[model samples]
Target: MLPGPRRLKRPSDFGATVRRGSRAATPTVVVHVRRTIDQDPPDFTRVGFVVSKKVGNAVTRNRVKRRLRHFAGDLDAQFNTDVVVRALPAAALEPQRVRDDLEDAWARAFARAAAC
Candidate 1:
């Protein structure tokens, strides 16, 4: 058998961690983040992606999700807390552009979390 793509499970978990968390906005992305002070196993911090039909067909949406996942992994070290990243329509833009936007949004989200 093959392993499925590693990803966060449970909407409730994402909600609880970043419900009232801070938000960072960029031209192409918006990131919502919250600190998770409680965890039983503390296995790994998680992230979620939300892309809507407005972005495009299945392929475009999946591409955006993949990009977001890669971007999230690159920023894993910075995210000491749990985060939920919601994709905006602009995410369908060029790959490098999307990456830049996400990086900016993440920086802002991290800054906000630190202030709290």
Candidate 2:
């Protein structure tokens, strides 16, 4: 699990990140990356996850979410900006695929962010 301070818990934050941030999508996940604002800790990068009913029932959704959280926690040290990862239905079927897609999405999203 990610530490509380490193998690994006507000609805408004999720909305803004998805609306204005750079995005990248792969087969199983989509990633949004946004530069942190002045009020946020200069060295801390927050992460949030979106696993909707469309991805699975409650059990499956939670499983996917847990998997994503673990992966995000591991990758947290590498991120310099806020990130939101949205899981697709495909993510419920294969953990390996989800991990691969998340990495790809992160790379692409950050690359786009860097270009701006």
The best candidate in terms of TM-score: 2
The window of 10 residues in a row where model 2 has the poorest summed lDDT is: 72-81
Residue-wise C-alpha lDDT for candidate 1, range 1-116, written one tens digit per residue: 11133354677866775568889988778888777677553445567778889888999999998888888777753545667788888788656788888888888898888889
Give the TM-scores of the predictions, in the order they appear: 0.82, 0.91
Model 2 / residue 53 / CA error / Å: 0.4
- What does candidate 2's lDDT look like per residue over 1-116, in tens digits? 79888889999989988998999999899999988765645588889999999998999999999999988886633547789999999999877788888888988898898888
Per-prediction CA RMSD (Å): 3.2, 1.6
- Residue 66, candidate 2: Cα error in Å is 0.4
lDDT of each: 0.75, 0.87
Candidate 2: where is the Cα deviation over 4 Å? 39-42, 76-79
Off by over 4 Å in 1: 1-6, 39-43
